[model samples]
Target: MNNTIKILLAEDEPSLGQIVKESLETRNFEVFHVENGEEAYKIYKEEQPAILVLDVMMPKKDGFTLAKEIREENSTIPIIFLTAKSQTKDVLEGFSHGGNDYLKKPFSMEELIVRIHSLLNRVEKIKDVEKIKIGNYTFNYKKQTLELDNISNLLTHREAELLYNLWQQKNEVLDRTFILKKLWGNDDFFNARSMDVFISKLRKKLKKDENIQIVNIRGFGYKLMC
Candidate 1:
C-alpha cells in the first residue's frame, strides 16, 4: 500500500545520471539510479518501479531490449527513453519497444519533470475512477469492489475482469474461447478452472440483481442478460 511514485533511471552518462536523479528526488520521486541497462533491468525486476526512465545507448542490455522484456511481464508500466539519437528510425524503434514517452539528449530538466508528472497524473486518474455500472451492478475494477443496487461485495481480480468483460458484451453471448484468450492469455484447462472460479464469484455478486444474470451456454460460452 506504499503508493509513492517509484522511478527506475538508467543512464550511461555519469554526470547526467546524477543530475537527473537529484532533480527527480527533489520532486519527491523515489529513484533507483543505475549506470547501465543491465543494472537497470536487475533493479526493475526487483523493484517493479512504476515509471522507467531509460537511456537507449547503454552497456550490457540496450534500452530497447530491456523495454521488450519488461513489456512481456507487464504491459501497462510506462517507459520513457532518453537518447541522443533523434533519427526517425530510432524514435520509431523506441516507441515500438513499448516506450510511453521519449526525450532527446541535452533536454532541459524542467521539460523532463513535466513529462514525468503528466504520465503519473494520467495513471492516477485511471486508478481513481469509480465503478462502471452495467445492468443493476457497479463494477469497480480498481478496488475489486462490486455492488448490486446498494449492497457492496468483494471480488477477486480475475472475477472483476470476467464481470467487466460480460458487461462489455451485454446481451451478447461471449464466446468461451475468446474470453479465455483475452483474459487468461490461453484456453487451456488450468485457465478454464480459473475462469470457473471467477464465474462463481460473479454469480454471487449479482444474486440481488435478479434481472441481471450470467447464463452458461454449455460447450459454447456464457452471456450477461438483463
Candidate 2:
C-alpha cells in the first residue's frame, strides 16, 4: 500500500499551480496538478488523492460543482477551495457544496499546508466510520450528517462527535464520564446538562426510524439500540 499522502491541485493559473505543486512535492506529498476541474475529477477517480486543493474558477467545471459531484460519490475526501472572491455568499456556497475549507487568493504556502494538515487530521479520525448504517438512516461521520429517505440532517460538531461515540459501542453501555472527558474535557454539571440536550435532539432525529432507539442506562450512560 502507498501510505504517502497524495494531493490533487486544480488551478487554471499555471504559475500558481506549479508553485503549489512543487511546494507540496518538496514536503514529500505526491501531487497531481491539473488546469481544469474535469481533468481534476478524472485524476481524482484514478489516483484517489488524500486531499484536494481546487481553484473556484476553472474552465471545464467550477470547483463548487465539482465538489458537489465528488461528494455524491466520496463524502470523506477533504477539499479546500482557492478563491479570489471574499464575498460571504461565495464562501458559504463553497461550504454548501461540501467544501471542507476555503483559502482566499494570495494565500501563503505555509497557510495552505496548515489547512491541509488540519482537515486531513479530522478526516483520519472519522475515516473508519464513514457511511455507517444505523437502522434506516445512514450516518456520514465525515460530513457530520445523518441521511434518511434522501434527506440529510446536518449535525453540529458536538452532536456528530457524541453520535460517533455512541455508535462506536452500539447496543452497549458507553460511560458518561468517558464521553464527558473526551468530548467536553470534563464532566461538570453544566457540560453534563448540555450533553443531555444533545441526547434529546438525537433521539428526536432518530425517532423517524421506529426500529432504532437510544436507551438510557440509568446511573451509567447510554446504549444505542439499532
Candidate 3:
C-alpha cells in the first residue's frame, strides 16, 4: 500500500497543480490531478481515490461542496482542504464539511507530504486491527462499521477511532485529555468540542443495544460498560 496509494488532487492554479502532482509522484504516490471541482468529483466517483487534496476556491463545484458530496458516499476517506483563508470560521467550516485536515495557501510541498504520510499512517493502523465485539454489535475496524442483527451502521473516521479507544479500555475510565490527544493530536478547546460531538454520535449508534452503555465519568473521561 505504500507505493500504491492513490491521491486525487484538485487545484485551480496550473503551475501549483503540476508541481504538486510531480512532487507526489516522486514520492511514489499515484496522483490524479484536476483543475476544477467538477472534474475532481467526476474523477472521484470513477476512481475512488484513497485520499483527497482539494483547493477551496475552485471554478465549478468548490472544494467544500465537493468534500460534502464525497463524504456522503465515503466517510472514511481522508480529506485535506487547501485554502488561503486562515480565519477560524473558515477552518471550522472546512472541518464541518468533512475535511480531515487543512492547509493554508503558499504552504511548503514538504509539509503537504508530511501531512499525507501522517494521515496514511493513521489509516494503516486502523486497518490493522481486527473486528471488535461490543454488546450486540460487531465493530469492524477496517471498514469502520457497526453491525447488529442484519443492520449495519457506518461510522465516520473520528467516530470509529473514538469508539475503538473506548472499546479497548472497556470498563475502565479513559481520560478525556488522553482521548483528545490520541484522536485529534491536540487537547485544545475546539478539538475537545469535536471529540464531544463524536462521543455523542457513538452513544446514539450504540443505543440500539440496551445492554451497552457509554457512561461519562465526571472530571475524567468515559467508561464503556458492556
Query: Considering only N, C-alpha and C atoms within 3 Å, which residue pairs clash in candidate 2?
Result: none
lDDT pick, better of 1 and 3:
3
Q: Model 3 over residues 163-226: C-alpha lDDT tens digits?
A: 8889889999989999877656568887777677678878899998999999989889999999
Backbone-clash count (model 3) = 0
lDDT per residue, candidate 1, 123-194, as tens digits? 565556566886667878666577765777765434655777787788889899998876544687755765
Taking all chains together, each candidate's TM-score versus the true structure is 0.56, 0.64, 0.75
Candidate 1 TM-score to native? 0.56
Cα lDDT of candidate 2 equals 0.84
Quick one: best TM-score, which candidate?
3
lDDT of 2 by residue, 115-188 (tens): 88877886776655549899999998777899999999886545677888999999999999889766544686
lDDT of each: 0.78, 0.84, 0.85
Worst 10 residues of 3 by lDDT: 122-131
Backbone clashes in each candidate structure, one number apiece? 0, 0, 0
Model 2 scores worst on lDDT over the 10 consecutive residues at: 182-191
